[model samples]
Target: MEEKQIKTPHEVIASGGNVIKTRDDHSLILVGSDGTVLNSNECSWISDDKDNAVDNKLFRSRIEPWLTSLFQSEHLSLLCGSGITNAISSLAGAGTGTTMGETTFTNYKNEIVSAAQESAQASGREKGNIEDQIRVANDLLRGLKIIKDQNAAQLEKELNSIISNFAKSILNSENGIATAEENKRENAYRVLVNFLLSFASRTGNKERLSIFTTNYDRLLETGAELAGIHLMDRFVGNMMPIFRSSRLNLDIHYNPPGIRGEPRYLEGVARLTKLHGSIDWIQNGGEIRRIGLPFGAKAITPYLEAPGLDNANTMKLMIYPNSAKDRETAEYPYVELFRDFAASICRPNSTLVTYGYGFADEHINRVIHDMLTIPSTHLVIISYNDPIGRVLSFYSESAHKDQMSILMGGNLGDITNLANDYLPKSAIDRATIRMAELLQHRMGATSGLDKQATARQVSIVADVSTSEE
Candidate 1:
């Protein structure tokens, strides 16, 4: 038997000739000014006293503070992909959570299947997922209607059935989350709360965080509620929230009682945009709106399923997965949603952080690519593995390599490990930041003169620490 060959990080880097990519062997890797690799010597990382060796701690120490500073950028946005959904789904929910799996019926009208396959292949996918099927079906349905084809009604019926099942599956997946307590195998919920709060916890002075997700699940909403974070989105309404094209650029703030003329932005308020549309969103009488769906629901909401209503059918779920569709539809919500995304991240001093995103969506990736055109804007890619070489390819093709930061490997991408080991506390104290600066100044002033004794410098550090406490 022959042993399979696996390339080391050094080999991967050399093969690309400076286009460093994520390692497939699950070795810890970092790219950028703070780059590090923890591969070749796993044995050395183990010791009698410590589970994670001193070197491992050192690697983490560098990245954590660096990430902390990046999160405090003038404009910050987080883009989430299906990686997060899979991470959450791994937990032991009471019932099977939403799987967002492939279409149940492989049997499609021969022409329809051909078009769908072509659509999937155009995007580099081997076959269309449920979203692809749905979009293709709709497009085909429209064409048939235009030509007055006799099969239009039949295709519409199948499309409706596919959508009904898809929406119900989404509801089921979210409901499964409610059945969970603490998933003992991996407490993803605990880490999820921390992961969200870490980025969302801006002081009143910084720009409000913008969180966008391709996922249709409501995990972010649920997580925000649990963390006591306020989310402002484009949808307006309470009973049945309508997606408005034009609304005031509103925000949440509070005024300190003693200070009459000034107001402070409320802490932890982030603008949420579901770029691919959400499962809860639907179109009724030519207007898009969000319906009330409880987390971990037992059935579709009565408000949505009411028999007489035009959109009472679950087929109206606003998830627009098939990107191949034309963006010219009347009142198209995706264009509006994407405009929010582009406007949020493509500005000066902006930082976009991606978690669990595989970079599969070309539409989203194009915006990211354009954002990097601005020398000041930055991107941070954090994922367990590249799966395909998309992550590496994006890095190599970028004109501004210095503006990108990447952390890849299984340990770094795990929600729990990322939250606990890498993320800084929710709020880093301003006084502590100042005290460190003071210490650095003291060290610089005393370095060359003190060769034998360091008592004075040590005292200065202690005094600074005492002041911080």
Candidate 2:
């Protein structure tokens, strides 16, 4: 990760408009010291003057500090949505941008199509993608089964095709990743690693960071591997990992002397949970298990080509293409996943920093709302745009307005900008803290320095210690 100085949004705009639909972009205003708000791309107040251009230090000075503090909370959780995949995948050929995309099996039933269209309009979109279709399909699938209709089989077949194609599109989007050591198209993987490390680089004293994502892709896991980050989930095994319901709260620790008093937390370890399940996961003999599904492989081709596998192979994948919009959390595994999410963040002094999440899942949103009930818990959302205005709407309607923070628009939401500029340099947090203590001690030894003077010295030292060489 190259360290870049804090520059203005325009100067630091290294990414494309991958996270689009900036309808609520202006909802979160960017203000500078002059009380000037920049609602547009350029800063009119400073653009004309060569030396007076508005640097994005306004965001750095404001948002970054809060994020730094939040990331250091005793309980820190990160909720990632499709926007992250959209941003990172954009680094490769044409980022698919939030849509699961279309499938060849578009011949959806009349009711399913109608429901999708209505759902699309409700979300302020002209049309819905595979997700909308699949969600409607799930609703119909359950209804058909309940009534014991003869048409249930046909609908199930169509649903399978839709889901398989949907999975294919997701795999295709992940082509940005590079498995070959020498591959040039590895920027996506690098970004993924940087993003994960930003959160995974936590202090040993605090609990392991909890990461919950709605994406079915395996980008996070791959990135964790590349970054040498150990990710712990419910699944446990060597050959085949089984999803256990127990909250073992397992973590990685090491004895300071390699054998002594209360082991210390090892760095670069995190707890991961795919809130919507994962592409590599499947239900086998009533137990959820994970398989060796290669990341970025053509979705169902490998399975179909295997010696003993058939077309039904993809069917076994545990990924259910639904966001539980209608409270579908009651279903198996998802209920447990939501329980993990709730337990992770719905505690005192918990801070959840959501990136690329748009508050689309009502079930997850409900837990977040409950988390906010804890006065010490905080919610910081960084997103491309509030397409459906849900992010902004949630903030305005919440009684705990003071506990929430929003950073929207492509300038701040893009993954590259986020890594190089916004998110706290977790690597330097402890160093800065230690240096501050040393400076305070040295200053106090010299004289009865005023509190203001001592603080100024400590702040300067911190800036120097963390700044890129």
Candidate 3:
């Protein structure tokens, strides 16, 4: 038997190219050197036989130490990958990725981690004091920010260095492993999608579904798309381009150069709201633009850099690290969306299922607290590190004592328990096991109902019988 070839990161990068594309099923497919297609089938090995488990012990054995090292190291902070922002935010001190503190901490941590890793590599086994390294990293990060604020063009070179350093550290770490077979990326993606679907389905009473994430990657969108759901991001605009066209017709139908419509929503899915911008989004002049998935569709052309911070007008929409108050302004569509989403989900009888998201952001924390205050609302938080019930215990307040439930295991079975314990048993039957499932089921049903009603001749039908009667 011939031994299969294994490619190293150096070899992959040196080869000069790789393509990270989503498969038809919404799972990621990485095309590396020599046309190697790394898909879910190849990557699912990390979980052993427990394919549906979120926190596979074997998987964690590889992930935990890598993550712990990254966090503990003084040199690395911002870990950017496809849909990684929210996950990073959850692990950072900020808890919630959407909050100002969480966002800032993510950037800060990235910078620090970058510097520390560089120093460690250079020192070569002479372990430095973690605190000292953190201080140094923080100083460097602050200095980079100061340079940016001063609008020093030369400072960009230094900023690039900091960013590059952080990237290198992550790439060197185990978490940086991108290959399907090595990283178990497929399992993680599956778990995430399943959780979202189930949560959305379980909360049938929710009129609208809102998701706020800091991840720049397309995993969530891809997952939603595969599951036949529509996603909306304030920065990205509406997923349903039809709505954009309708709005444009009201303003520019008679204009000389015909106005191009924005992205539209999916027919049946709930709305997707991205708090941070997406990787595919671009900014030009002052207008934000996005790439079209359709083959013949013209790429969106913006007047400004798609989401550049250098442009004063464009900066508002960009997800830069800052304080909570800074994020509440209307100019920052993402921030506004976050606030609105919080209000919507915090209503009475609402249920929020937070999976990988840790309560790190104070802004999001406040929102959660508000939700907990509602008498009818329920909170279900799933974490591998802590039991679900105990996880909610961390947010202890006089009012929220009995309001939240925690599912404290690492498997999908825990999710089943979490849903059953917090939600009425009757609700579980209608509940989904993944985010995509809920979006598909709800959107499909709603669309069908709308069509059926519109097809009927009678405008109004009186109910002749009632259960009470």
Candidate 4:
């Protein structure tokens, strides 16, 4: 009998298994039917081996037919997950070890150890003091009580401070956002934003642009503003935008005085909905309000304050991890926000393109599945790893497979690049013009790119132009 050859991680996943990365960035382990490690690569998460790249390319080519179907749909919505945010930071040379996904227990553990060591040395305490602090952080990470001789309250405060600082680092005005990154070429956030803007601008005036995000970070908002695209979020007014669910349904229009003048659309290319509440959002008198702060602020504390209280509202309004997330969504603004998300997905002729969002949120997963029942609704899920649960089930089902496309082990650049290429001529043209305008801004030129240059770039790359050279 002939012996079988060892299969790569991608091959294992393609043959119906999962490729999960271990915490230590050690290996790409393949999980089997019974949830056991069937195989693993003693290498990086993104392998540089020729065989892996070839397999990825081949798999992508095989999925082109499905991609075509998704692109041809009338409406498009995008879901940005933590994975894509990490990709943005990595590509932008702005990795502060502080994106949403990097704020895990493991990362926090290391941070705690370093801080404890420094504090002990500065206080001239014995070496064992550092070790004692280390033990506290480890116990907290493992969901256990602090060891004897350590103050529980102190340890808890330290833990919270570490986590809060990590989140704040990722949200810092200077280096936090993905849009602040210099290079637009490899920046996934820029590419995704451009794709969203293109679809929203070129689509029919009545057709709504739906963008829903589970992340609390401002990557999408930052990118949208830099690109001169307006997001129609529930919050209105510059100082403090009050959150009203009804406002999401409103649209901005401009009507000229002349009888023959057609009403022109002014703002709101997309309905930017953050299902999970943001750091800037605060609860005031049973309602949510967006607090605007000056750039380069130190922390979340000094900015948000309850009425007539000396202390700041220290409650960070973010839906942190799983299980607890369900409970959090039941709260004030989240309930209203999620309701809009579900409604948007259910709309006829709507298509949602999800990036990096693992179908982990059960509430969101259920609504996505329910939306599929609508005949014209479509879903395109693109993630760095194989999708789990209902996402996998729906992708494998032959009945609705045509209406859905699941591209695993793919980057945001890949999905956006292919979709932009496959979009209709009108969308591609509009996107090219918009991209050219952005490029001109980057060059510090006062005037916009001429139609001749815009048309040339639109036909070629959709984003790149001769002026960029």
Candidate 5:
């Protein structure tokens, strides 16, 4: 007898078995005996573009091998991990070094030992005084080691204290739900702050410098404050003073004494330009009031400053998400501020380095796209995900595919490459050579300049057009 094919859900389940059912409309459902549906076919399995997926897979296949080869070596892993651990340890210690302090001392001692040995070898003398010097050096090294150990213990205590406080704050007696969003914001701020610090350290000089962020959070300001750099947030003329005060007072310890003076616009420091209103800032009674800083440090002054507008409330300074194009008028000082920011970044030979920002906001994206159109401007997008680059690439191609061959041509890579590429070649190359020397001078410096440097060098190659003219 031929076996009856399982057709209907009831027929298949009746034989004391599970049944898989597909509807006439290509919907899939798994049903059990008692009319229990396991999975309903609400979503389609096939994606929009199978070719794109295939292309990505192929690209990954080619790139993964190279990445694996680059990172797979045992020595590379050890060195990378050691470097990261050292950095984390140093940051964890902050003003004081615990484990990092010891590591640093150990490193210094090793250097001293190597230098002394070389000196002894060159002199060709078994001088007893040299032995004594070595002993003294050893004694000093031992002292440093002791100090480091003590520091480490102190750091652990401090960390434990902080952790305990954080735990107490997070676990409320009343509400069972955690402040997860607050924590996430805090974490995001930390990450952004670190990136800004790194950027400032790299680009800051005795020349003109500025930073503009559309975020309302004080993360950038906090990071700049920790790094001992003054952060100035540009709001509407009315809102500037309050925002400035709030940012300045974020950390009382870091706030410069007597901050009542006129805002001294300094060069070579972190200038935070907040296109949108800040979290701590509030518009009240035709005036702006900036509240406590991060970690809840209250401002000494009221910080209730007003811009030049007569109707401050009507001015609409804060640009929230989903802001319509109708809001982009001269009446809106915040909008004007964003336009000014775009102008500042679009200056000759100016390079904009963006971190974690997807440029999805049409307003910001349009500004960036316009900047790219400028012959003198370069854009360096540093995103953890490919979405920013992909979007930018798409825009670039859509706008100027005929003119420029590369999509997102200006060193559009990940965070590390973005940091390395944004600076002058001389600076980056010098850093590279110095780092190489530190690691092992015997290896010598890596030959050939990076792409940016090479491009600059080529542009300056005898000025053939001028010669012809």
Candidate 6:
């Protein structure tokens, strides 16, 4: 038997590389940032077992210290994708369904699958599988829309249904069931919101919390409103609010009336940057206008064909799933919005904390990878399943894994259990302390993920005190 070769981070960087791309030996051999080879294949920071469980104190002990460290940073940003919405939807009694692509193109699934089968038969090889064919059909539909052909009518109709379903699903969760006692369970959104509130009280840092989400839903908006927090989304007008990118650049500062009072920057304000177009947004004469009505109310108008071409504009404004997304993102509003996301990642001392986001989008992933190369930047990925398999090749080939932290499985589920746990406590002070405990214990760690990365600043800890954060 021959001993396998391993590469160190220094060697990888000295070789004019920043990530570990691959290995000649296809077997599972874990490599550290210092280039040490270990028998294990999992990331040093996370465990491999799907059923491994950690108590609330231990889970809190693991997450809180890291969160505390993040709070210590002058610049911090939170980036959320589809996973957060799914977690909330599940909590709201709406079961998670097929991907947005499958839901939108449900009517053409058979046709697409048949086409793939025929192509395989013609080629006498495994060519377009069902998934591949579905992708191709979606791309074809997107191309038709881009060219302004009438053939995309069906695609538009299918998209309307998907948007309406998503709207209704998210809106229903707005009222939300009481989960105060259930706080001990790991609910992503619940803990995220609570953590933001708690951190705001502990730190006088007046810097606005930049929340960048890919979802078009209004759950977070409603959540913030219900909590009585100031959420600045850059739409200024009251009667008919229009999105202005410049408004986000403006800051609010308060000066004390007394001579000795120091000027204070307003805290607890969050700037929401919706990278993908929001359901409430409609383009009028090239300007993005927002409807003050609820998302569910606005989402169904396209399907009704209510009044005239004016009403039809709402449905046409949606950015559908599949290949068209890249092109749609380049258009007005989205282009500006995506630019904000890119800029947020590059901020100094910026720690990009992600929840429920799978690094599926190439464009978004590219920005993150670029940011990692810069100094004083960190990436924390918390997922219910293996979060690094798709990026393992990239990590293995690069020398920049030192700033990356991957937390998978255990109590790292999309929603904090405490988010669902509703309890009755009249004692505000005591309940606050108990609430903190519940939020910490309720986590859904990554589970059922295939492969894991184990190089660089990664370590697996059974005890919560192991982290220095």
TM-scores for candidates 1 onward, in order: 0.80, 0.79, 0.45, 0.61, 0.40, 0.62
Estimate candidate 6's RMSD in Å. Answer: 12.2
Q: lDDT by residue for model 2 over 352-431, one digit each (tens)?
A: 98987877666677789999999998888888766656676677678876777776666667787778777778666556
lDDT per residue (tens digit) for residues 1-469 in model 1: 0111223433333332111222121223322222232232432323445432334365465566567667767899999987776677665443434554456443355666677678767765566667766777777778889999998888778887878777778777776566666554236677778889888887666788999999888989988988888999988878777888774778998897899877767887998998888877877878887877777676665758754347566667787683653452223888888888889999999999999887767677888999999998878888766655667667667777678877665556667777887765644434544555566588765454343133312323343344234
In model 4, what is the error at residue 372, expressed in angstroms?
Answer: 1.4
lDDT of 5 by residue, 209-286 (tens): 456655443434545665566554443343234432222212112223687553332322544556655544555545
Q: Rank the candidates by TM-score, best first.
A: 1, 2, 6, 4, 3, 5
Note the clash tally of each candidate.
3, 0, 55, 0, 3, 57
lDDT of each: 0.68, 0.68, 0.37, 0.54, 0.36, 0.51
Tell me the tens digit of each residue's lDDT in model 3 across 259-315: 355322222344554555543444444555554432111221232233442452322
Q: Answer with 1 or 5, whichever has the higher TM-score.
A: 1
> Model 5: clashing residue pairs?
237-307, 238-306, 238-307
Give lDDT for model 4: 0.54
Instruction: Give me the overall lDDT of model 3.
Output: 0.37
- Candidate 4's residue-wise lDDT over 73-186, tens digit each? 556677776655565555555553243322223445666556555544433332323223433464454453424434555555665665456547646632444345456434
Worst 10 residues of 2 by lDDT: 15-24
lDDT of 5: 0.36
Answer with 1 or 6, whichever has the higher lDDT. Answer: 1
Model 2: residues with Cα > 4 Å off, grouped in runs: 1-28, 31-53, 101-108, 117-128, 142-150, 179-184, 258-261, 304-312, 324-327, 436-469
Per-residue lDDT, model 3, residue 97, is 26
Q: Model 5 off-target regions past 4 Å? A: 1-194, 202-207, 235-240, 243-268, 293-319, 328-331, 386-397, 401-469
lDDT of 6 by residue, 1-469 (tens): 1212434333322332222111122322233323233333532332446322224443344454454455445566777777676665565454552244333256566666666555444433333432345445656677888999886897767645555565554444433422222442224345546634543332234356778877766766755665555777767788667878684376555775773566665645667877766666666655677766553342345443433225544345443332123564576666777788788778677777776665555567767888887888877665544333433444444566667654433233335542322111112323443444354467434223311211111221111122212
